[model samples]
Target chain A: MNTTRRSFLKLMGVSAVGLSLGQLGFDLAEAQAYASKLKIEGAKEVGSVCPFCSVCCQIIAYVRNGKLVSTEGDPDFPVNEGALCAKGAALFSMYTNPHRLTKPLYRAPFSDKWVEKDWDWTLNQIARRVKDTRDKDMVLKNEKGQTVNRVDTLFMMGTSHASNEECAVIHQAIRSLGMVQMDHQARV
Target chain B: MPKAFLVDTTRCTACRGCQLACKEWHDLPANATKQRGSHQNPPDLNPNNLKIVRFNERMTKEGVVVWNFFPDQCRHCITPVCVDVADMAVPGAMIKDKKTGAVLATEKSAKLSPADAKAVAEACPYNIPRIDPKTKRITKCDMCFDRVSAGMQPICVKTCPTGTMVFGEREEVLAVAQKRLAFAKERFPKAHLVDMEDVSVIYLLAEEKEHYYEYAGFM
Candidate 1:
């Protein structure tokens, strides 16, 4: 048999263990039980918030050596009181999802593809567009000749994941831009 | 004292918080799902799901459309047939925890051959066990053995906001179940506890067992 170096190592490794335990077959039952015990044992926990909806349920993220081992509802949270809806329960998958974007993605108008952009570049682009839209579409007066400092070009959509303080800051920022059209995922 | 669960179907709005909380506590992964025209996702229980709220709609005798929500899970049988059958195949495959009266599927169950696992699965009156093909392991609810051992209620029972699910000492739970049954019977004449004597997880159904689910009881 023409065994490659990798195959030779595997063969030697298998035989070495097999030879150590002469007649007895693998103690697979013991191994399986051991595996289950290894799962939840000796794990540290970190506190986090479920980012799905307005409930903002608190969660305890179990970590083993900086890796997230599991997540569960935080019993101490007053709002959810350790209860989590389907969306809130799926927080672990949402965080560990392979499709989760690690960088800001931008797509030009009418473009079908998204291109990754750095934080500075993305921020600068957003600032430039907001300034241009505010300058171009700023409404100074209505038909009644009343002073209405509003911008119609930009619409602000807020996230349900935002905390109370974060939402306040976002509301203030949008108002400063004279943007009247505002909505949030919380109501949905 | 045996632990009991009171699952009041009438109070269940089917928010599926119990379902999600069970999955989170067990650290199971998400299953691929599609819109199946019902709020029930993934259709039925798999390795990833230990609890599911089944949605069923039917017309009453008066010709009014009625929708019913059945939150289904392992009943944790008092004398679990699955435990007896699994023990016959593999001595420690399934064990009835003496402390909490939880019928737990030990990791040793993975050693049971496919045919043996099938026999154990079939032994369940509720058809609760699902064998994971990839891992070749039999999986089902363990009644949160770890949590219960550490003086915490099962995650599903703790997370039920509607009080549809409850867990406590077996005697205490039965008392609560009896009290709720008496209250429920006033409104729902058909209200009764399904297989209350045989199972640790007692379900207080407001309708006939068939109206809840096919295996809601063991005939």
Candidate 2:
């Protein structure tokens, strides 16, 4: 009778695990495949690239209700396949950060604070400045009397945010203006 | 089957991708931070941040500088003592999900008195649970149950760049952890899995447990 009772207790212990059956010898709780609605479930998968470095790992931006909801490294991309560094992982917050500037801000030469400027005003001002600098610093003739048309004072610093095609256009436009000094700031 | 994590600390580069990924997945808000003279930011876990990578650097007995990175989170115990302690105060306040081996503190946790709430947090061996002063809700990692149940890996495991944080079925992950442990044993004679029998998440430490964190393993 004691043997029967002990055997029943053992059976009860075995039956105590959750509804699902699992492999023996591990603390695997019987988990059912519950389908929780994904946060980005219905969001459109828009492909893009990480704007932080030249590696430019592919990213899929999740857009829901016409707003960017999330971003993750694209699994399909061979480079950095579904893996991201701290900066790359923080792409979502970079877009949603309250400190992010949504408009152009202009500061006067001697001004202590920045004032908001319209895009038209900002672009026109930039064009005028670039033209003025190019005209003032244009060196047409070298020491050897060579026709080396280049700007000596204008330095064109490029952004990592520009795409490959955009970078090519930027290079063409700057070269046409006879600017020689150029640099990029992509790290890692 | 219950999911598990095999965290190999030796492989972790401490890029904090897991930390950021958790925040992104949960839609947790950012906390204000200052230069605390360490890479361990926000210092401790709060409602806003469920997971954090703890950085510790100190000299060993041999005068060797040892820098350790611990991606800290709640180790949902096999038989959770917190759930029992919480059940006495508010019945539905804290529950252990039988389906997923997930310990979750529900909205009813707000009903728990301040003393009871503090008691629950204090009961955790790993010192993981935190009671929000404003909400009175006992907050910690819920094993990322929502994502795991939906056939998706927890954000931390998915975003890890160095292949440090691995998540999968309990038996499979245990095998992985043991195999890695065998490899680690060659270099680190003292390397072992931390509280593997009692917790869902297992950390494979390269050296003594105290070197990583004082509460890294439960005796």
Winner by TM-score: 2
Tens-place lDDT digits, model 1, residues A1-188 = 89754345345444434432212122445324422242444567678888776767888787999899777777677787766776776677777889999999989999999999999999999899899999999999998999999998799988877878998999999999999998888776
* Reference-based TM-score, model 2: 0.86
Question: Can you give the lDDT of residue A128 in candidate 2?
Answer: 98
Q: Candidate 1: global Cα-lDDT?
A: 0.79
What lDDT is obtained when candidate 2 is compared to the true structure? 0.82
Q: Kindly list the per-residue Cα lDDT of model 2 for residues A92-152, writing each as its tens digit.
A: 9999999999999999999999999999999999999989988888999999999999998
Q: Residue pairs in steric clash, candidate 2? A: none
**Residue A106 C-alpha lDDT in model 2:** 91
Consecutive 10-residue window with the lowest summed lDDT within model 2 chain B: B144-153
Worst 10 residues of 2 chain A by lDDT: A26-35
Question: In model 2, what is the error at residue B35, expressed in angstroms?
Answer: 2.5
Model 1's TM-score against the true structure = 0.83
